[model samples]
Target: MFPKTSLHTLFPTVNFTEITAIDMSVNSDFFREDPLHENLDLAREKITKFQNKYPMSLLANGYLEERAFYNTPNFERTLHGVKEYRNIHLGTDFWLPESTAVHVPFDGTIVIAHDNNYHKDYGPLLVLKHETETAPFYTLYGHLSKESLVISPKGKNVKQGELLAYLGSEEENGHWVSHLHFQFITDLLNETENYNGVAFPSEIEKWKKLCPNPSVLFEEEF
Candidate 1:
């Protein structure tokens, strides 16, 4: 969906060339039958490796991990509540250390900011609504620090690449790795601070229209 739209750089503060892509396919140790991602201890070790390797951030743009992103018991309780379902990831996962600066993708307004804390959930989330003459969309940054809980006025205008928020710790950042769950949204569907970051395989088409592929922002350089 993003290919048709001319999207601008999301983080003007950071150097895009420094960002690196991480492969979570079967080839990687993390994707093996019993991968490191399945356990918190091993996951932390891997995160430390990423922190040392990529100072900018670790990007997991197109990771479809066998339909388990939302299928876990924790995710089911948070998103579905009743139905036990998991969905494939739809946005670029920017893995950064705690307090990493999160910038406004484009000229936009603060639509929503709240703490959506749940294990393996988007703990503290922010939704920035952008409406340019040529481009109109929203950027969702999840797993932000508690400071993001009270970012600013709901309708305040934010410039492109402004210091928007900072990354939160694992305790506040949904018990997963310390990273930003960045998703692009074309429609809010009445969702304010928190929205579905995972999409069931059956609903990928619908979610795609609402959340465009954010990897387009880095495809050229990577």
Candidate 2:
């Protein structure tokens, strides 16, 4: 369950007023031209160009935005004997450079610190279990570098704003551009190492309850 009060005061939150917000949704100008359809290199180039436009500013994509970036077989799924695609993102992505520092947003215990070594996988993933008064929930950090595992190992206790990890390179981060795939999970559905970061558009309402928007913790209104 989510916290009753806003988590913004818990730590210094990012105001999008300072950080630039990039539209990676299907309606965005870049993706509207033509689908990349598994051409991650071109997608990275476009994303890099957007970030370079506003030098030194962090670029972010908000939660629940439907994106076409996951065009590979990795995002395909079967439902009711029919094929469906998982394109609706469940978290907010902060596009950053490789090795960019990522910090914890809350105090929690490291439940998972493992590398999922498959293509389009969360190369270095960390899941932290945060206990609230209502119930225990989890936060997931994906696309982190190898050094993160060494810094925050499983079962380790971490504090708010502590250095959690660094953004992994495209080679290490599921072959996508460097970014932090941050998500909030009310339940892991018995998962350990990783959790579904995207869902089928048809079942979005169901997944939304399981995974709330990570932006609720941000001071900047979404």
Candidate 3:
């Protein structure tokens, strides 16, 4: 079970309604309806173009959206001799400028802060563990600035509304557009440095239960 109240905003003093909601999923009107066929840089350029279109407003992508952009080999997995593709995103993304400060939404202890520096990977990922009346749950912040590691290392206690990390640049944040991939995890599945931010469409039901929609924190449906 999760708490229903007293959560803070990840960003300070920003109006959530003012933020623009964009569909970056497969068959999206914003991006191509089909899977993109290009290199990482080219794919990133497409995101940049969308960002440029909404320069003044914050952009968001909904959780559980099926994205065709993750067509790269990096998203492939060999499971039991069968190839599995993880394209259904499990987290909500906030597209913002580089160096944007990210704050803690609830009182928690930093459980993990590691740099997963592979191409199109989640760079400088941070996981915070929060204790509730029933049990403890975890929150993950991905594509964060490297300085986030020094500021909020593992085993550190953080308060709500406290600065947790800043957004990272493209060169450092997995070579993608600057954005925060925020997710909620009821269980880590024994993962340490990284957690699955996306899942196969067939196994989406399981992942949806493990990583519940984070929109409750924002108090809006993206």
TM-score of each: 0.78, 0.85, 0.85
lDDT by residue (tens digit), candidate 1, 1-222: 333222224544445345566766435555444442557667767667765777655455444433433456554433455464555676678766688787665677888888888777788888888775666678788888888766644777887656788889888887777777888778888976578887766667888888776755444443
The model with the greatest lDDT is 3
Off by over 4 Å in 1: 1-16, 25-28, 31-38, 50-58, 63-69, 74-84, 218-222
lDDT of 2 by residue, 1-222 (tens): 354333233223333235677877777777565464256677778888886687756576758988876665778887789887788989878876788777777789999899987777789999999888889988898999988899999999998778888889877887777788888888888887888888898999999999998876665554
Candidate 2's TM-score reads: 0.85
Cα miss at 146, model 2 (Å)? 1.1
- Against the true structure, candidate 1 has what lDDT? 0.67
Candidate 1 — which pairs collide? Answer: 70-86, 71-86
lDDT of 3 at 148: 93
Error of 2 at 11 (Å): 11
